[model samples]
Target: MPLSAWRLRLLIVSLLTVSFLGALDHTVVATSLATITGELGAVEQMSWVIVSYTLASTVLLPVLGKLADLVGARLVFLSSLALFVVASLFCGLAQDITQLAIARVAQGVGSAGLHLMPQTIVGEVTSPRERPKVMSWIGAAFPIAILVGPIAGGLITDAWGWRWIFWINIPVGMIALALAVIAVPHIAGRSGRRFDIVGALVLGVTVTAFVFAASWASAGTPGTGIPLLIAAVVAIVGLAAFIAIELRVSEPVVPLRHFANRTILVCIVLSTVIGVGLFSVVSYVPTYIQMAYGVSATVSGLVPIATVFGMLVSTLVTGSLASRSGHYRAFPIFGTAAAAIGLFLMALLPPGMPLWVPMLAMGLVGIGTGAYMNIIVAVAQSAAPRTDTGSVTATISLVRQVGSTTATAIVGGLIGVGVTAGLPASLDASTLTPQAVAASSAAVQAQVAELYSSVLAPIFIGLALAYAVGIVAALLLPHGRLSDELEPQPVVGAENAAETATA
Candidate 1:
């Protein structure tokens, strides 16, 4: 009755594939923002589309990761996938930015399930030794999806329309859903414990408030300050309550025991740093190109390809190295160090330099960022007991999300508005008026690019500092291969046929 080897492998692939749908949706919207803004009159509200989706995913990752441990992953995985597809439909059909933003919130909730659950599902189905190789596929899928997103968006938006961006997810989501139901392993919920309602509420509010403050810190100078202060107060109060509730609750939402491991402590610190760099790079690159070089949206989307290519290139090389040497620490150490250097180098570029120069700079950062994931995540999970693997995986992810969101907010604030007060002499617009600015927005957009390029260095430097911390942590990680004894025990089957299948 145990699943055939083929079915198990198929299940892993299916989960990663569905997860990729959610990941792809994140980046695909970046290049098409201009079109969405123009059509929906959402210039000011445009940032929310990215922030909301990311914030939702960040907040839910820890909760859902723990949920996967409590209730079986099979149920949670399918439900999340179904929600993502439905939300995509709503997003595509939205008439206004407000409607689209609301739909995006739904999409974000669905995406959290897709993002966190797949890793847990993979852990459930594959042995610890086999997990690295399978996880490589998952890690690789992330950059590939991100890289392809813009190209696909450009082609679709240019040929058909922006709606196609969301529309394309329909077929992919359904296919992943069908495969998951057919192929994924069935897991049952753990018994004898109730959901920690007080803890869940407190943590949820804490994450929500903090994420909003961090995500929207760049909205305006005056606007961001008070809200950020309020959010800080809410986060502190909520976190205090969460800790108190967890201490008293018979069953906590996140078991504090999981944080006791030294390795996990190191991994969490490193993940936060990596998160800051990775998210900062992804969020700013497209805007950098558009604002600095006066490129069209379609053209701007292509800039990320350099980073994507660098990531792909490094992944293949380092993966082979890890496999050959059977040592993982060296890769992350090198990767993070290189990434810090790359980010610093990017800071040196003058505003509005040639396209190829900036592209190469981003590529360097990509190479470094791409190399860190497999090494760190694998190391972190290996450090925890088997029963806590899902928890550890989710924890790293949660830290990264918080780091990235925090980075975006900080960078957004530093970069100020992506607009310049002066236009270049080469750009002749003698009749520049507010009315004309509205009609011929492209000209105004050009000035913004010049300003953005000039200020990109400081953002990269801040990112560089984060990656530097990650490198230091990677160096301190204990060096050894993962052992099965360190893993969680496998579940016993419920019936004769189920037992046979599990066997």
Candidate 2:
């Protein structure tokens, strides 16, 4: 029987709240990171804020998705909501950067469940035909989040303080929890098989080893290279172990067998590459604007709207065209090229350029990134067996997370190296807050912009080159039609969803 209107409303509220919070945290800290690091006095470890949240959440995506499948999303979502609320309290009370990073990691564990389970919950409960309304609201959260997260982070940091950005989740999470208990029906577990604890542990350790190594090296701490080398060896060993474990396990985190399909392999490669640059922009750009252009956190928050807007338009229009035509290859092809151009523009941007210049550049990037946002996942799902649909979806998410992990490590290292070498002792990472930059004379501001441009130029160019590689992968992707009957839950993950809806 269909849920009554009242129950349905409560259910949708819970789902949207869960999704929005997950999505919000992804970008919300972008504007707040500088201030957080500044206040906490750890300039070199600044990327940990984004790195920890993203890395923790990223590695756990597949594991959590599978757990939801095995145990039921309702149980998982409630547990995750409770964890998220408590972790937020920890984040608010954190006494140091390390403490905050640790809290964010715990928070990310909850976010992993909160992010993926909503769609799963709704899928388990609702009739397929009735989903679009709920799904659209869920889909709407991505765009709204990208808009609100940074702006709200900036405002909250400027006013009550950055800790409130986290503490704020407490009330919201509690409300969602109440509404969910009142409305969402219990979904019994789908399978009685043992959970893949080994697979999950192996995957998590491998990623953490790799990210820690990269982040440590990026910090430029003396005498740490040996430890970095050790982390690298551990990552290699852990990856081997993970592969071995997966091949032997009954239910793998990501089945190695799926790579046998040519289309599946191509889809994974393309998704991984696009994902490398897709989310990292939000991680660093606002901080870049604040540090380089002397913009207030509020204005910095507003900048990503250009990229999100571009992605939104491109996703909607291209999704519609591909749906009607069933020709899905062009979006990735053209979209990647456009993103490359946008990055090129950003890389070559003159110091002291007008705000609109970067805005325009990011818009092109959005246009480009939006092209492949949802289509790639739809194609992958179509190519996989229906029985393995959810796992396949989660695996794709895992690899994309891997890609972002790579981006953050390499890019974060580059920034750390640049700041250590190029920036003078007078302008420590903590000292480069918006207030400090704003107080500087025009000549000093221009000088800092030039220094920032030089440091950031290669990173943008390098990301552009990454997109160029994605274009090559997209070209190699077989000319396949997107499935008419896609899994009702999004495989695009919670990052962006409505693109598939337009189809």
Candidate 3:
């Protein structure tokens, strides 16, 4: 029987809740990092707290997605939520950074499942025609979480404590768990396919090495270049091995044939490009605002809310339009172009422009990004064979995460080099905080602003270039209406028999 309307709505709400909680974890913890490190007395190892979760989550994404395909999404989703709740409890209770980091690893495992399974379930439940609308709701969770998390984190951390950041998840997790248990149906996979353990290992190693290299590069601590280089080599070798193994495996964790599909490949590329642009802006723009305008951290943090608001509006509008028209290629094409224009406009902003200028530019970028947020995933799932849905979805997630990490590393390098070049010999780059900028003489402030603008211009230009690449990819996307029917799995026996008959 088809799912009832009310049931479908309930299921979506449940999934969105899971998605929000998973997405919120990173931003909230990031905002509370200082407090966390201070209370735990592990300020020197602060990066590990965030890095550990990111590495674990990135490594486990495909593994958990494969597990969902093997066992069942309902089982996986519920179990992950339970694990997240338990991990959150431990995180809140931790007396030291080591324990907190360990707990975060567990949380990352849950987060991986939470992030991957909900979208997979959305694909399972909705017809391609309706998927855009449903997926828009799901996709909106991340930006909403991004918008709310920092402010909430600051408030909660200030009023209560950093532990409350983790503690807050417990209630949300419980609610999502209850709703999921009631609303989500069990989605069973083929029983005969063997798990590809070797492929999983290789892929994990490749992702870990790549992520470690990017993290080190972004950290830019002196003497880390050699380690980064070594990681890059390992990542290259591991990725080659992974591809080789996947090609030979009967049932691979990631189906090699998906890459052979031009449409799928293009969608993946677009996803990565969008990820780079979106996350780069989200991660660094606030810092840019603080430095350029000498605003309080709170005010600068609030500036990104305009972007998130724009995203929310565009997501709903474009998603509905795409679903109604049963076409999606236009969304990405137009969206990417809009994003590129916005980014270019941002790059061109002169120092001491009106405050609304950057915020408006960010809003434009958000609108462009939002238009394709869930549409690309819907398109990829629609294009792939039913048997490969989980794998395709996981691959999209993996590529996007890698893109975000890569963008962060690239932007960090650009800023680091630019600051080093622009700052005078007498000025220590470490002392160039917003507070310091505010305290400096008028001449000093003007000089710093000019230097900052010069550095930021290139970063924004780079962002525009990424979106421009996305625009090309989007233009190249195959024009096909979303099929009303669910994707069909291939029949191995029938294919073999047909081949024999032809011979």
Per model, state how many residue pairs clash.
10, 0, 0
* Model 1's TM-score against the true structure: 0.83
**How well does candidate 2 score on lDDT at residue 244?**
95
Clashes, model 3: 0
TM-score of 3: 0.94
- The local distance difference test score of model 3 is 0.83
Top candidate, metric TM-score: 3
| CA lDDT, every model vs. true structure | 0.72, 0.75, 0.83
341-368 per-residue lDDT for model 3 (tens digits): 9899988988777778888998999899
**Regarding lDDT, does 2 or 3 come out ahead?**
3
What ranges in model 3 sit over 4 Å off? 217-220, 487-503
> What TM-score goes with each of the models?
0.83, 0.80, 0.94
Tens digit per residue, CA lDDT, model 1, 2-30: 44678867876887788678878877898
True lDDT of residue 40, candidate 3: 91
Query: Which 10 successive residues of model 2 have the least lDDT summed?
Result: 493-502
Error of 2 at 379 (Å): 2.9
Off by over 4 Å in 2: 1-14, 26-52, 89-103, 119-139, 154-164, 178-190, 287-302, 319-327, 419-447, 484-503
Model 3 CA lDDT for position 287: 77
